[model samples]
Target: MPESRKAAAAMSKTGQTEPSAPATETSAAMGGSQASPKKVSQTGAAVEKIRSRIIDLTIPPGSRIDEPLLLKEFQLGRTPAREAINQLAAEGFVKILPNRGGTFVRKLDLAEIGEIVVAHQLVENNLAQLCRLDDETLADDLERIQTVYRVEVDNRRYLNITELNEQFHMRMNQSIGNSFFHDFAQSTHRHVRRLLVHLYTLESALPEQQDEQFELNVRQHDRIIEAVRDKDREALTEVLPEHAGATQDRLVRLLQSNTVAPFPVKLRPLVLPGN
Candidate 1:
């Protein structure tokens, strides 16, 4: 009921977060902490805060999480904070260390990244094959989304463009009316977005290069829209792979170079061939 708690709850729903509150008595329990039923909403907010940081690479990959510091930062009680960390651990972004105190963000593994990309491409390819985006109402919906994307593109709002791109993909999957595939696609996209954020953070990937890629991505979306309009499966397949392949290669190249952002823990890139 407190103002801070209310704000936290709102942030949880939007997956946006603020700086963690300074540590208090609430910071005591971390690993084995237990939150009460009443604190569930606050716990969720804490989780969102953590997740947002992870996605933005603010909580860099392979970084050791400081429970007390996080507790202080989020101004959350022990139970809620620990629960949030545990949830992240369950989501595979954080690893719970029984021997070591607190949790750690998982290191980026090139092999795992490749698997995620390939799986995403297959799922999307299948969705494109089955989706009837040519339906008048559905086409209108996609057109509207694409309109917003174009606005972002013209304004050079690169980050907003990324979000719009994800929205476009999510909408495409949702239009299929398959709840299972929709949920799977959502998870895959989340990982893909995080990878993109990580890639953007690297020194080797200059801002101009990222801008060029964004332009290319927008053009590809234009092609995909045309493909959907014409109901051309082959065109859809081609454009979709091209879109994903560029990111895949950029990710691999970032892994191959020695330009990783600093973190408390050292994460060696899983050296896979074809880099």
Candidate 2:
């Protein structure tokens, strides 16, 4: 079977449903006149399948996405495939180069990494202040994710660790009860996740270290949980940014050492002020 087909099947079995675009908008974007509601729904499903692959790096960064291949893989018509690609482009996940017909996943931006760190700090600090979090509210959820996270760390399942780590933070953010804040935080988490996976994949090729970083990550989770338990807003303001900043630093060091390069793509790098 083709890779996309295999992926679709696997996702079907797993019942994974990370959110994606709305079918109505997606169909309209790709010439909706001929699009029935059923076709539009299929277009949405196709978009999610491709989006999930990008999120997990299954398609890997720097890979070109052939529309014909996607159409064939998902058994989607031209309108649906084109629509999915267009949606991905708008979302910053893929780029369509001028004079180049192929669509490629957007490369990692070195400068944006720093900016994302700063943005995360600002947003999370505000969230920490606005929300009233306490142990009683977050304890059960945090404990459940932490249990799985610890096991993943010990087993050296870095990808699983990344997912659970995000879940742990997601649970913390859920305390805010504001959908907009929660969604923003989730998007930031996805960017951070790509960086983590990049480092872990690079590390896998080298001599095995003591896994100190993973251990520290777990400890950081503990600290965040404790801060929530104590209703220590000051502690949260300090630790959450620190956690993201530390990851930023690590990624920079890795890039500097040439241990790993950003995913190769055609788009110009996003350079923020003072970057």
Candidate 3:
């Protein structure tokens, strides 16, 4: 089966809903009644912290997850710590090995990254094509998200920028009202979040370049809004690839730069579109 179909089937069995935030499993874990509210809150906090570290590359890819260190660092009980790891594993940020091989942070190699980019483009383009332009509120909702995304960009909050970007595209996908596509898009966004983090991190040292790239993103988003409002499928098709391609271009350039440190996982040559 295709990976997206497999993910859809898994989500069906798991009953995962569209996530407003990057760490949807945290919310799911918090909503469970097996733990006290305080413990649940702690678990949620731990999950967010750990997940953020992983995304930001602080935890590094493929490193063994230290449960005891997490408990001590987060001041979490054993149960809460375990719960947090379980949630992260489910969310694809962590890999839980069988037979006590120990859990590790998931690694992204060049091949996996290529597949993710392809899947991302497929799902996002499909969503844009199928979206109901006459939904009346679709443009308005996207405008609201873009507003917040602009703020995060201006504030240089890379993490918030990534989260809002996901929310922006997810809102578009949601407007199509297809649960299967929504779930697949949500999964792709989840995987893309970490890559965006790396992209933003690479640009962190170059304020001028970063600002220029972010401004371009804002304008692309505006064009997307305009396309939606005007019911212009041609404009949507033209702009969506450009917007996605910008990130791909930046990542390829950054990876090829000598100043950047090596990734924990071995990165083979990246073959993006037009490369």
TM-score per prediction, in order, is 0.69, 0.71, 0.76
- Candidate 1: pairs in clash: 20-73, 20-74, 21-72, 21-73, 21-74, 21-75, 22-72, 23-72
Q: Rank the candidates by lDDT, best first.
A: 3, 2, 1
For lDDT, candidate 2 versus 3, the one ahead is 3
lDDT of 1 at 35: 53
Error of 2 at 32 (Å): 19
lDDT of 1 by residue, 182-273 (tens): 65676677677677766665723566765666677778888878888887878887787677677766655555565654334333332323
The residue ranges of model 3 lying beyond 4 angstroms of the native Cα positions read 1-42, 98-100, 261-275
The C-alpha local distance difference test score for the whole of candidate 1 amounts to 0.65
Predicted structure with the largest lDDT when compared to the true one: 3
Candidate 3 all-Cα RMSD:
9.7
Query: What are the per-residue Cα lDDT tens digits for candidate 2 across 72-156?
Result: 7889888878888887786667888866768888775655555566666656566666655743758655765666566566766
Task: Single out the weakest 10-residue window by summed lDDT for candidate 1.
Answer: 20-29
- Give the number of the best model, judged by TM-score: 3
Candidate 1: Cα lDDT at 84: 78
Candidates' RMSD to native: 10.1, 8.1, 9.7
